[model samples]
Target chain A: MIKELLTKERIIIPLTGKTKEEILREFVDHAKELKLIDDSEQVYNRILELENIGSSALEKGIALPHIRDNIIRNIFVLIGISKSGVDFDSIDGELSTIIFFIGAQRNDKKYLPLLSKISQMCSYGETRESLLNAHNVDEVMGVISNWET
Target chain B: MILKGEKRILIPIFSEKDMLYLIKNIEKIDTEGKEFILLRLIDEQMTKNVCQRLRRDPEEYLSSIIDSAWNNLYYFQEELTKKEIHSKVSLKTGNALNELIDFGKKTKIKVILFSRLLDSGFEGIFKEKLLKNLLISWEETIIII
Candidate 1:
């Protein structure tokens, strides 16, 4: 169910951002370009607000920043990989290398399950490494599909 | 950040059953002006433990756990809301003990509550160390399991 939303076009390989905001804006811009959102500014602000609720940073260099709004039609996901990692105040106090920017509509039923998928996928050290080494979108999708299967 | 002089209680939930049991126990409390937060830990690293030892699909294993935790949280939240009890639910991924301690200190928790389940006995040594570490970190907070 989650794999359908994580297409190659929705992915970013080797994201070029030093700060959390920059990385988030890059992803939000991608979603905008895809026409997934009506207003990028509103979606960006909403994502930041959700982030402010708590540091979405999990362990093992992964952070899933998710927000649900009525403005978006369906769930739009953007996966970004950063080798240098950014300090997003993760609980483990480690830099986050893989950032998942998830924007879901208020009525999306699969939202929670997608979050569950991200949580489960990021839990594996091997999966984290695989994501970091993924050179392209297909490789990233392959890594996720491996777990899904 | 924790507010100045705000008393809070921390409950770490593992499953819907665990949360239901905890809620049943908590129903006896006064809970007039106190705040409660239900925390569900989705430890991703723990999946490695399952994959290596149990030789199972870590994603499916963790997904079931996440689903159960959220479902239980939703049920408990509805019950609390009906009773007019102020509470919040939190979901995070990491070690349960470390996250508990971190959250307790950050929220200035006055007490930490847990629903005592049957002991595994196999992980006695690890559980002892975790308990000792948690107690040592939050010496002033009362721990009720």
Candidate 2:
């Protein structure tokens, strides 16, 4: 399911953004560049609203910033890897190097399952290390495929 | 005083059973003019113990637990939205009782809905003593379904 939504184009390696806000904006902009969503600002704002409620940054170096809005037509997963980790207020207080920004329509049934899958991937130490070590889109895709299999 | 337009309901979900029960009985609760906040709490000690027993990394285990919790709560959120109910999902990690109390105080919640069967899942996490303490900790209404 994740493989279908996340193409090589959606994965950004060594993301240039250095802060949480910058990384989020970068993901939204990349989504815009790929013509995945119609309004980047709207999606960005909704993500911020959810973050204000609670930080999406999980333990380790993973952050999953997500939103479900009416404007989104489908579920999109944008994976970003920041070599210079960003301070995303993670649960373990570690910098976030692997970020998954998810956006989905309010009624998209696959949204939760995709989130669950990503979380499952992050649960494994080898998978998390593999993702961080991935130097390109193909390598990241390889890590995801290996995990899913 | 919770004004007519300011009333909010807090439903703290401890497990999948709690979510299922709440979705099944959402309409019976008086949710009119009130915003619903679905809260899911991850017990830190429980996570640590599980990780230690399984020989898993605590950080990765916690990330997975948090997301799995979100998955359950969001499914409930979607059901509420289908019923045209406005709602939000919150995930927190800590002592369940303390988190509930702190969240209630921070949000000025007017009511908290808990499943009568919650104790079955967490080895009596919501036992009589804790429930009584929760009742005494706040003046708001607590409905155990």
Model 2, TM vs. native? 0.62
Q: Write the per-residue lDDT of candidate 1 for residues A24-120, one digit (tens) a residue.
A: 8888888889988889999888777656544567666888777777977788678999989988766546799999888788768777667766766
| lDDT tens digits, residue span B18-104, model 1 | 677777777655566655677775556655675678788887776676766655654575466546565656666578677877777
Number of the top lDDT candidate: 2
**A1-149: candidate 2 lDDT, tens digit per residue:** 78888899999988999888888899999998999899989888877766655466666788888888887767899999998899976544689898999988877888898877786578678999999999789999998887676
For this target, which candidate reaches the highest TM-score against the unseen true structure? 1
What are the runs in model 2 whose C-alpha is more than 4 Å off? B1-14, B19-70, B73-145
DockQ of 2: 0.15
Residue-by-residue lDDT tens digits, candidate 2, B17-96: 76897898877766666667788877788778778988999999987778778789767866776576766666777887
Give the Cα error of residue B114 in candidate 1, in Å. 5.4
